[model samples]
Target: MNSKSHVPFIRTVKISERSGKDTIKIRIAAFVLALTAGGLFILFLGYNPLELYGTIISGAFRSKMAFQATIRFMIPLLMSSLGVALAFKMRFWNIGAEGQIIVGAVCASYFALFHDNWPHFLLLIVMFAAGAIGGGLWGLIPAYFKSKYDTNETLFTLMLNYIALHIITYLRDGPWKDPGSSGFPKIARFTSNAQLDKVLGVHFGWIIALILLVLVFIYLKYTKHGYEISVVGESKSTAKYAGMNVKKIILRTMVISGGICGITGMIQAAGSDMTLASSVAGGVGFTAIIVSWLAYLNPFGILLVSFLFSVLEKGSSVMQSTYGLSTYFASVLQGIILFFILGCEFFIRYKFVLTKKGGK
Candidate 1:
């Protein structure tokens, strides 16, 4: 034993870039693994996975009404996700979309509540503009700090969301409280003039969302600004070497991101709620981050992923009714899926290998 015995083997992990097809395969594998894991949990709870999955599919798509409801849910998610995608593309962590949405809706409500005397088209125009400006300004604040002082945008934007929520709460409980609702805290609903028209049971906001999708796709694919954003995202040093205005780019990108998010809030107010409230955004702003990442920040990919999430959201209610389970179970499933998706990236980028003790 003292005469130079050799060890068996050793292992080490190495990182490597994966091909496009391999990346897609890994993602698919992660998805399957997540579903399998979820099924195991369902089995442990004494529920039939096949039946539950079938119910989800049918609830989301079997009936015209069900499909329409899913579509309605998809609209805001799609728009908000696209908005988040814009900032994410440039490595900007804009976590304040929730707050930006609230600000936009609040600004738009100013017109709907008091300026109802204006022509319908004019009132709508004002609301849209107000929403965009309000959101853009909110987004610009974080960008300014990040550019000037290198502030942590994640915290700044996140804190802003709480502020926006408080603002809505104050407005609802104090100034904008509907006097007609007895003691209940409420904001006044918009008049018909301030509402969005529907075509075939879908609000015109769907049309706007679709148009923005195509525009965003084109902007990222073929525009010079999009290329500049790509360069900046890859490396600020490279962008600077290329003579790009980094600070201006940051501000401009955030404005676009926040403006789109604001429009989503306006659509929610005018097209769905027809009133402003703390829950007007309905958590779409936060959900949009998941949507954007799952879609790899591609506009068309966002649309597809948004639709899938909408199906889960719409179908989850049915699951609660049929299985007597909490609707939050759907959220749990989504979290599991995302967790696996993110975990799979590690395997895609790295692998462990075993070798002889003295092997290179």
Candidate 2:
């Protein structure tokens, strides 16, 4: 009936069968805990924690490249998180987003590579469509298993991730292997027109990401399908009793989720990398799951939180350069934040009472 995270800060929130009452103070306390943990880590390294924090903020916004990097990172994160959020609205855990992303990249890349000279605009359209279809199909696969045989969707989706990885590996060393290239282990270089163009020095992927965010917001807030998803997520029995096709919504939402994830793959492929391989997903799909969870599946909140992660990643590069810190240090920082946020979610749902002085 309820889920819990094995985080230490368990008293931060109290969640229930539905929405639970909450106060802002709990959030502030959790932040304080996160900041304390992060600050202590810096102090343990014998570095000025204040300088580290300051450097991060400065790097994120003080330079053009830094700003662009933040935007670049934010776009995929926003797109993936929104997709995750949409499915989450239906309580459908489609964890194969990473696979869907890879499938999309592979589809678009293969199409662009083999297809004869078509219009530049047409090529772009094909790539986008291919990416969406690949991801959608990957997503639908799990839905099929779940609806047709009552398979555990979480496990079904999770397993698909490895399938994507295996396919990427096979291609990197086999069919898609470029004869001219050597041990770097990647795909062949794509054509110039295969890449997405920049608008005002920022990749146009950001524009698409923003447009999708708004579209998702509108769909979830105003549409009947969205209403169905919410109902089905809350209860299959209730949804069925209400004459809503619960299984259909689950399958439909997942397809949409996967399609968006595929678009994200396209951004990394054509918009940024201009090629595809195992690195196509860039772990954004996994991270976006948390972003969606933390944002409570609100598209607008995902925008803000995704921006936060983007800044952290951008500033992390500065941390590496200015303080001679490892880029892994940023991962440490993010891990800490995620720990706290996830802990808070659990606490929002459950509680522990210390009845004895012994603190059982």
Candidate 3:
């Protein structure tokens, strides 16, 4: 007599032909599931999930002031995401937006502190240009190393962030320290000429951010340089075979990327902070990475995601004030929501199949 055995086997399969409708449906499902999970967490904390959700919505849009605040929060995040999207489109993994932003702020502040006698518009322009140059140079360092030595850009860029941060510390405690402050280490505030004027109720950074959105969209979708970046991102060998100068492309793209992020730093210092500080970046550089990925590296998508994230952040603050919840709790809620939405991408691209096997 022969013995037979049966077993179940599982295999992962890629879904290469998903439609737009299917993708939307999966995302919707993931969002609903995330809400459910977050609701349960709220329940466990002895809170009404529905009420909390409503609070979040109203808090972000309840008044003109609230709306303005949300826009303010969105400005740097939107700008930084746009910068990161450009580099990511080229598959460069430029994680040094934080460093780039810091250096830009430092450069902008130099003009703000010393060149206050210039006309207001001229001063602002000079600061902007200085910031762009500063950030571009800072970003170019990693790109040069990567092109020459094939170094790991991710780590290089990340390490640069710490160095840039320490630069601010050195300035505040050393050369740039305010002599007027009594025993406190801080930089001097910018003069009126260096400050950004308001358009509605908020600073004009929002207007700049919108302009950048259109520019980046057109740049990525229509221009030759954008096309070259896409080719390089797909395959360097193919790019080289197509007669494209891959090294030049890498260097130029990073300059643009870092320049945009530098503008973010300039805006933060001049438009909001009115002074450069270590907190000027405020993790906006890191948060922009999440926004860039969530938006699929599309400039328009980045705008939408950045707005949504701004709302989440502003609303979370309100939730904390209203419910007396700890900041960590709000962060956990945000993390839970993000995890579900991000995890859904895996399902959109792949699926599992089970098969039965028999042996004798």
Candidate 4:
């Protein structure tokens, strides 16, 4: 449908460390540029940009519930984004994480559906294993094809998204439909013991997510495999030439990426939603791409940017009704923001000058 939310096909570029300053400047410039674009759009639509933004600010920050909602939204997005960031760092495109999350959630749901009476400890094990295995399998499909037949992973993974959506829809409507409900769409409520704990009105998934950030950070920084990932991502041919097992690393890193995404799905099922539905994943796989990009492939940066996205998303509803701003306005804002960020990269990498090198 090419909605305004559609992410453009941005070729991955591994920026050097030297560009860190440029990255900061880009963030500043992108904010300014996005604001300008948003203002112009609001004027064209016969609305005040100031009013729209002010409403969003109050809506997003005025209440504790809004803050909790923001954390809830950020946690899964951060999880999925971390997965994507790892894959992107390795030069592997995991566009099917959306599908992988569904695979994980669907599998976790089944575990609880049947093992509802198992002890909490054993049930947790069963759920996590199912979720990890499910997402890993989903990831393997694309990796297998890419590794064996040199297939285009981008297309392969994109198609998997729809396949997964249909699978969840079928399960909820047919086999797993709650017996007492007439037309509602959802599975039986999941077992309570299988879910993550709520911390101060929020899920412990956020806490786990933060711990993962540190672990993944250390994993990539100090481990030999992380070194190989960077090397292979830099050049597969070069990696192979240097005695690194290119194929093994590809499969293994992807498994890691997929496994984490599966955990994200499990959290959504166990901690947040407590059941399987067509909307279980909430398009998180796609949004994670934005998070990864904004984080500049830095896990710590992903953590902060994720929370920022949460605010905008949760605030959109307020903007919609409080100021009569359409939902489309949110999409416009994201687009403009992304545009400026992408454009800023150009300024960082190259400088414009006249052919004479002096005259304008």
Best by lDDT: 3
Local error of candidate 3 at 268, Å?
0.4
Ranking by lDDT: 3, 1, 2, 4
What's the TM-score of each model vs. the native?
A: 0.94, 0.89, 0.94, 0.90
Span of 10 residues, lowest total lDDT, candidate 1: 3-12
Error of 3 at 69 (Å): 0.6
lDDT of 4 at 32: 87
Point out the higher-scoring one by TM-score: 2 or 4: 4
Kindly indicate the candidate among 2 and 3 with the higher TM-score: 3
Give candidate 2 misplaced runs (Cα > 4 Å).
1-22, 345-360
Q: Residue 2 of model 4: what lDDT? A: 54
Tens digit of per-residue lDDT, candidate 3, span 1-360: 435443337766797968999998988898789889989988998999999888877989999999999999899999999999999999999999999999999999999999899999999999999999999988999999988898999999999999999999999999999999887699999988899999999999999999999999999999999999999999999999999999999999999999999999999999999999899997889889888987889999899989988887888888889998765554566567678879998889999877645411
Give one digit per residue, the lDDT tens place, for model 4 in 61-110: 88999888878888889988988888888888888889989999888888
The residue pairs found clashing in candidate 1 are none
Candidate 1, 187-235: lDDT as tens digits: 9888998998888787899999999999889888899989988888899
CA-lDDT, candidates in order: 0.89, 0.84, 0.90, 0.82
Worst 10-residue stretch by lDDT in candidate 2? 5-14
Where model 1 places Cα greater than 4 Å from the true spot, the runs are 1-16
